[model samples]
Target: MVWRALRPAFALWIWLAIGLAPLAAQPATEDTEDLLQKAMKAAVARVAPSVVQIETSGGSDILGSGPGMFRKGAGPTTGLVVAADGYVISSAFNFANKPSAIFIAVPGHKERHVAKVVSTDNTRMLTLLKIDAKGLPVPVAAPKKEFRVGQWSMALGRAWAGLDTPPSVTAGIVSALGRIWGKAIQTDAKVSPLNYGGPLVDLQGRVMGVLVPASPRGQDETAGVEWYDSGIGFAIPLEDINAVLPRLKEGQDLKKGLLGIYLKSTDIYSVAPEIASVGIDSAAAKAGIKAGDIIIELNGQAIVRQAQILHILGEKYEGDTVTVKVQRGKEELTFANVRLTGTLSAFIHAYFGVLPVRDDPELGEEIRYVFPKSPAEASGLKPGDRIMKVGLAGSPMQPFSGRDELTQLLDALQPGTELTLEIMRKGAKKPETVKVRLGVMSDEVPEDSLPEPATLKKALAPRKVAPRQGPPIQPGQPGPRPGRPQPGAPRAEEKKEQPKDEKKKAATGLLKRMTPARDHEYWLFVPEDYDPNIAHALLIWLHPAGKNKDKDTEAVLAAWEDLCSENHVIILCPRAESNAGWLGSEVDFVQQVARDVLAEYTIDRQRVIAHGLGIGGQMAYYLAFNARDLVRGAAPIGAALSNQPKDNAANQRLSFFIITGAKDPLAPAIQEGKAKLAEHKFPVVYRELAGSPQYLDAGTLQEMVRWLDSLDRQ
Candidate 1:
């Protein structure tokens, strides 16, 4: 058996030997390690003069808020002299701490010169500083067209040594390109705070890119700062920066361009870029792009997925005109010269003031309620009309047929635009087409004539208003009610009232505490008398910025407890990440908290409200606008709108209850924001305080509670 196994092994070895014999006899190539080492030294010598050291002193340890949030590092940073006219460029992060004094040290100089900030490119995370002297060494940029992966890259910095000392260098290869959505190039070089603001040079010492902290996840001064010393690093190509140098020198802050369309699908991999909601005043709307239009190509690049669009246009700035080709239904449409904008005119939702009855899931929505003075009423649409199709008589866009689709369509068109609606009245044999001009959504709350929500009535029908408590009636004590007998001593009482079902406690009275884990750690207050069976209103309290968060939580609970107990309200207060305060990114955290409460407790979707005061109030407005699908009511006290909100027809159902103090510093802006919102036709209930509000009186708190309860009204 051993001999048989050895025979098979020997035969396999002989076959391998035959296969490798010809290759093993070939000659080897010469070594290039020493040659490459000498070349690298020469390259560093060629580029060292352009690099400089920047030192700062006497500033706060931490810088700006959110993405710009910075922690002062221990060492000086590196910068590249970009021009001979005394203009030097460095990472924006080097100055993020806002040092009281800035000084620059050039190569081979024993003394330093005070440098002044010239202009900053916020988008690229670069800053230009000016000195008194000119004739600085300016590095030559390698042509970007010649860029390729696997090419040698050397990252140089002046972090460790004096101006006369050789600069520190890390050598690696270009790992990728068009990173950070085409804004950066990728390399495997060791990059960190030590080398940031320096240059990534080629084999011949030609500058390829300016190194800055970056990551695929974000674009910010400190976004990639966390990855210090990691092999992965980013450098903005000098070729791209040179193209934008003129604009940067003009001191214009670059803003990301906006298309203003919310897509229908969240699937990142397979879903094409399809418009679900178009802001009425957005570039997309201005270019006549409609819902259901699939973006086929952006600029000149073919886009197969939503991410492809982001990759192509993510780095584009406002005022950039992009030609787009879209597939609308079966037709291919081209829209050329769609100029993007960083800002848009305020969007106001056009309204028809009609509520659809949601009785059958399979049928088109039927009209259940129509406001007296709305476009629906003016067009002679009745309460029982079933909407079938919606659009203009002759238009390129197809007629929208679904209830939700119709709502999006109406919101896309501005007020006073004519729309043709195909509707079938109760007794009609066929659908009739009628012309209805869109109407502005009013800021006023719906009148009392609107129908009561059947769900609310159904939930409240079984519960009896528990009588107020008092000292237990003694045998001879008079009854609490005007004529009722005492509980234990009354002979006329037909029977002792059945014991109250205290077991089924409702959220009422004092607020109960809860804690949930999220990006924004939050405190929750559920009224003690809250009913688990019936849906309750949830109020997310955002307070003005200040220290003493524990006190803020207490105050929010104290102000809303009685109203909460009486009306079944739960309050959630999410604290800012740090004392530096609120960030636009925190909006996601707030939404997570709301969804958590909704999931863990019984909460009313239509009665979900965002209420805040001071900075908290501004955040409340921010939360409501960012989480439009979750919030039904926004009640802010003495805060202006955070930014112009995107207009949508489905969210037209949103309502606002704003209280402003005429004497308040932000009062005018608040009123203007309210006016802009009202123009979009959002139902707004405006309340004016004689002056600015120092406190919310008991009466006002009660009124706000009533507004939240009424949020469910048709």
Candidate 2:
């Protein structure tokens, strides 16, 4: 189907090639390869005037690091002319260092011209640059829809220089189309840091796409950079670039458009696109879409699976309107003019200040304890009152949908907002609707909180559990030791198949060490009696500066073994570089390691914790703020807040446990951090220890584990 559409464009390219060079139908020879090289050179020469080399000055080396993909050079990057009036578009990576000055060396221009960032398209990871020059050459954009796999593609970039040559160019075929969720065209041409902002041109020099580092699985700018020069490359379609060029001309940075709906299922491949939760103030909710609605179609495209939705919406930017069709019950509802946004109004989880008991004695949601002076208590509500329904004041009542729904509605509301709660008192014949004003949560830790209840003991006293070991090698398997077969080896046909999860599972033990990269190392501890079927909490420890000491490994194993066994907990200790101190840049390295562990282990999504002591705790705060999707709980002990926490991810709730010693000098900073987080409506449990030591004691560790255990509480 695509080839049929591309026939005209392909035909035009063939005729243009013939006109450019006198060609004859001849037998294939060594000079045929030379003819291909000449064609590539001509294609590059036509676009050479628009290709510019960019250089930066006076910025830290921090921007040199990228997530997922490692980059080799930080010296310079490439750019392309998007307009004749000096508006050039380059990869956002070029200016990521926040350089003090930028200069561009344009083709045919002897001197470099000063350039400044005009706007950024974060959704596509491109930055538009403006210079004082005028009448710059702009290349023609090839029709993206007419692209075909195996089509001749040429990658051009000015990353390096030859004495008399234009930009460096590599030739290959279009490896794939509609890659990066329909955002980019994939080419096997070796793409690297040097040619990132250059053009992927056709045989006739029409721009097909702007070369960039991108991954289908990752949306960030640095995502696919490691594959540079590795026969896998990506480029943002030039047609899409032209469509958003006007917005970039106006200096408005573009961000990925968001619908603000959390899907019900984690398995995107097979699960239908059903909303698990919808932001109360989001476009989906405003359009009258509910949580149970299954997203059946988007922008007229059928959306059968969750991945389909991601692919369709992957490149959409703010202000884009999309038609959404959802199935509610038997009715298919189409919502037109559903506008998307890059940002949402800050959502603060308004608190009612009630701690429900562990178990319910009534049919409805029961409150075990109400905080003193809380909205729940002020509204004349008491312990043992069953909350049967909740709704806005003067509205019809709706059934209470458990703590999660209640929490979501509360989070969607601002402070001091008034709402109604239907409470059924014990032995009461009827329920009463009480008006309650939403309030802020207290940061005060419980004065007398008990260690996680004895359910952990029951879990520890288990009947049976799987032994923590790597997958068993099949009979006759060569395994890591090549050539030598195992005893009683069965041939391939006779071997029993192992479950997919077991086959690729990670190693487990008290201290199983893994090095993800050259300088990256992490240790994971899985209890000997680990149960693969049961979800386990993951506690990632970030030790204080230089605290990745010789003794730290043994100490961690000794300290957490009992707690891990008592409760289903997996401990991960990621080694920081030198422990000299944590840098803000370490966030990527640490996040990468955590992601690896999460992928390999059966981690409880709700109970992931980032616990760091001292300066390490500071880094933990940074990690949690940025890693809102993964780290549900953050425990920063004896450390100041180095960076402010970001607002929660859409529909995500983050809780924190801040610990400080009474006599510690950093106690004041800890207190300040707790107060600030509370102001933002985040749930914070402030724990003050008795001693001045910058570490938690045994009892404190016990309390910490209990807190970690309860993180999954509804």
Candidate 3:
């Protein structure tokens, strides 16, 4: 039996060797080609009996929108029979719409069997189905050790109708091994919805893996569906699936194991596995892991870079035990049998009750505004009080230099945790220590007007100019006007000389007809006195359908001019190609424009926001969720949430500022959306205007600006 199993593998190797041999030493061209063709056909015939056709009836038209969206077709999908007693496996994406009924047709079987989903492996995005049938043909699984990059492989699917119809076959070579963080094999063969749950077989007809859509970045069921027929395809190795088949058979849905530790750097390739913060009540925290420890090994695998740790843990499922080793100050610690969990407590951003003044950290983190009924308020902490140091109670206080450092400290703690702060008042000689308990972030807007930020305050301050001492100008020559340009003056002919580099200097003030690329146009408004030294916030404005005309652009600029300058923000309004409305496909164009602006200007990454109304507001939600790496906040005025919001994460923090009128038609939906975000533990600020209106009022606009400015608050 062993030799029978090994014979095909040896023949495959010999065939491959001949195919790759030098031209002079190769076999006859026609004979070799004929043999390859015959082998491919035989392989497909061997696996065709195990392939099944699945048809789902009654489901939603499409799942949400944007990059992660999934659309179900009205045709049948493919599945693989994994057991003799009617156990089958298919991609979870085929049933993402929660179909009302599922029917599976086996080859040579005249009747179709009704099937029900037994369980799912969320980590690999695979689903197992059970049908009341017997003696199903189970395909043989190829050994993992036999898989080689460049080996000939064929993908077979039974998506086509009719019991006598042959399975569809696509032949290619294995592109890679241990891909998708060691969970899948990469293939050059075309894979799509048609063959998602079909078998990828070797030249000998043994099953190599099960085809599935997967992405390294996203874990949703339909995450990597966008890469269909793109030469880059993924298949989970059969051996890996078999190892967890017993658990899945027991009706226990599997989830990706989470360590619940945020790293210090987002660059996983070059950075060491250094912990920045551990989620409260997380598996890592329960295992006694703390912040600042550098992980050196996990599950017996040496972890040098952060990516290595991810790869090691990517294949792990909930309830699995892993051993972790980390290096502290001068000692190495090893934690054994640390069981992983599927879910961690949703991260609630702890509130310290004070907004730090931007760009004014010379003495320490100087407070710009203190929230009412907050920890700082209860402790008598006021604006202009610089925090010198902060730490947990009974711990050594660590001095911080700026708001960023203070934020890091606060992020490592949870709500209800007691803290000690060393505060230096505006006119105090000595610092005073205050004790306060942290609380959950508030959603209410401050009723009182907020003090100006540092930049605006400096801009508004009166300047003292020295007496002019230049050579006396002739009567006809332009006089030296101190801090002023005389009107109707010659102005030295206002040199229009271009820089030698020919790179167009970024223009300030309202800029119209700005085209980032061919067939794409947007209007940008940069503060007239924009400074590269001072980081500015970015607000991407999506105008309502049919409201992206020149007049509308001008009205937006007119309304936001003073606010942008005062708040150090830049306004970007992208015009849709069609005046009717925005399309889901346009998200890429909008994202590209936002990237161009971020690259060209010194934008504060933490304060980047997406704002819009009506249809535009829906697009804003799409961009914010799809482009989580770029946008930190979203303000959807008079727009209801169209797509479900992702769970909040400590590293990729996202906040929402939702505004709707009391009598607006979307008020109820908007309120429900706000509740959803809050339930996900995302910080949300919701406001309801007095009357029905298509746009924000002056007071609401100002309040929205305040919300944007405070996004960086810890």
Best by TM-score: 3
lDDT string for model 2 (1-714, tens) is 432333333222222211234434434343654556576667877888888889888775643211221334666778999999999998876676578999998877878899989899988899999999988999999997779898888788777663146777766678888888878999877777888998999978899989988865445556566566678888999999999999999999999888877665445788677665566577876787766578999999998898889888887898888999988756788999889878665555567776543212122366655667788888998777778766566654555333433454453455676778789897899998899887855544444453333222121111221121232111111112223221111112222233767665446686645564567777878888875545578888888876786588668678788779877788888887765766655677888877777666556556788888876787778678767666878898887764344555434667898888898887887798788887666778887989876567888777777677555332
Candidate 3 displacement at residue 245 in angstroms:
1.2
lDDT of each: 0.67, 0.69, 0.77
Residue-by-residue lDDT tens digits, candidate 1, 1-714: 222222222211111101111212112211233344456677777888999998988777864322234467868889988888777888887887678888989996668989988777766788888888778898999898999887778788888767776677776778899888788888877787877898998878899998998765445566677666667888988887778777766777666687777665444468677665566577888998876577889888888888887776777887788888988756788889998878655556677777654212222446767777888888898777777655554432233223343454454456777777677889989888888877776544444434433123222222222132332111111112323221111122211222377554433443334444423467788877655545577888876667327876787677777767666678888777767566656777878877777765666566788887776677777667656667877888887874454454333357889988878987888888888777665788888887777557766666676667655432
What root-mean-square deviation over C-alphas does model 1 reach?
A: 16.5
How would you order the candidates by TM-score, starting with the best?
3, 2, 1
Each model's RMSD to truth, in Å?
16.5, 11.8, 11.5
Global local distance difference test of model 3: 0.77
lDDT at position 112, candidate 1:
92
Off by more than 4 A, model 2: 1-31, 64-74, 215-231, 276-281, 354-373, 376-444, 451-537, 542-550, 561-570, 573-605, 612-630, 636-647, 657-703, 706-714
Backbone clashes (count) for model 3: 0
lDDT of 3 by residue, 333-379 (tens): 89999888898777787787988776442535788888888888999
Best by lDDT: 3
